[model samples]
Target: MRIGLYPGTFDPVTHGHIDIIRRACTLVDRLVIGVAINRDKGPMFSLEERLAMVEAECRYLSEATGTEIVAHPFENLLIDCARDVGAQMIVRGLRAVADFEYEFQMVGMNRTLDPEIETVFLMADAQHQAIASKLVKEIARLGGDISHFVTPTVARSLMDKLGRG
Candidate 1:
């Protein structure tokens, strides 16, 4: 069975994220969404809260896309996570050339770590290309409406975190 890993902080899963997950599902037997535990980046939500939100968001995806969706929180190196999960592919979403530059380097490093593993990049839908967790947080922090960028559950969670809900 071919398995792919999509790793991200997923501070809150957005509609764009769901779009990519849906697309990745079409190409892989199983897609594991790996939520990285990045201590460097202070997050609005706790790791446990983030994991639960992702799990809830993905439940609909499993049914709608007919793909197995599994959520895991990882603190180890991404290559290690891939190996542990038997993932032969790393799936990423590219929003712009900047993303390409970063993802390119990451792909090269992952290849060096495990030559058998391959990284695949998918371009985000144009509408969501500008949407990111950091951007979402900024908007929410400033009391800007983000209902259009994130899923309803994610939007609600962000609002709750900002004490606006």
Candidate 2:
């Protein structure tokens, strides 16, 4: 089976992420959503919460697309995480030129680490290209509507996280 790893912090899974996940299903039989445990980012949600959100969001997508979607938590190098999941490809979502520049550098580093693993970039749909988790959180924290960016469940979670719910 062709397995792909898509790694991200996913502090709160946004619509942009769902768009990528839905599109990524076409490329691989199994898509592993790697929820990064990066303490450096100071995530608004806990690893468990993030995992639950990712898993919940992916369940419907998996059923709809007939693809196996699983959420895995990882604190190690992304390349190592891909190896652990036995993934032959790393799927990344690109929003803009800025995202491409960073992802390009990451692809190069990952290739050096494991020349056999390929990285695939999927451009975010136009509707979601501007939606980012960080911006979603900020908007929620400031008492702005985030319904357009995240699912209702995630929006509620963000509100609760910010003590606004």
Candidate 3:
């Protein structure tokens, strides 16, 4: 089976993330959503919370697309996570040139760690290109509507998490 790893903090999974997950499903038989435990980033959601959100958001996509989508929490190196999941490819979503610059460096580092595991970059759909988890949370925290950037379920979760509801 062709397995691919898509790693991210996913503090709160946004539409942009769903877009990438949907697109990545087309390329791999099994897409592993690597929920990174980056405590340094001080994510709004805990690892378990993020994992639940990713699993919930991806459930329909997996069933509809006929792809096996699973969330795996990882605190180690990204390449190690890929290997642990038996992934042959690492999927990344590029929103803009700024994202590319950072991803480019990551790809280089990942390649050095494991040249056999290739990195694939999927450009976010235009509508979701501007949606980011951090920005979404910020908007929600400031009492702005984030319905456009996240699913209703996620928006509610954010509101509940931030005590806005």
**lDDT on C-alpha atoms for all candidate structures:** 0.90, 0.95, 0.94
Better of 1 and 3 by lDDT: 3
lDDT of 3 by residue, 64-128 (tens): 99999999999999999999999999999999999999999999999999999999999999999
Model 3, runs deviating above 4 Å: none
**Candidate 1 — which residues are off by over 4 angstroms?**
none
TM-score for model 1? 0.97
Q: Candidate 1: give the clashing pairs.
A: none
Task: List residue ranges in candidate 2 displaced over 4 A.
Answer: none
Clash number for each model: 0, 0, 0
Q: Lowest summed lDDT over 10 consecutive residues: which window, candidate 2?
A: 156-165
| lDDT tens digits by residue: candidate 1, 1-165 | 989999999987887788889899998888999999998998888899988998899898899888899998899999999999999999999999999999999988989999999998999999989989899999989988899888888888998898888
TM-score of each prediction: 0.97, 0.98, 0.98
Pairs with steric clashes in candidate 3: none
Give lDDT tens digits, candidate 2, residues 92-118: 999999999999999999999999999
lDDT of 2 at 109: 98
Choose 1 or 2, whichever is better by TM-score: 2
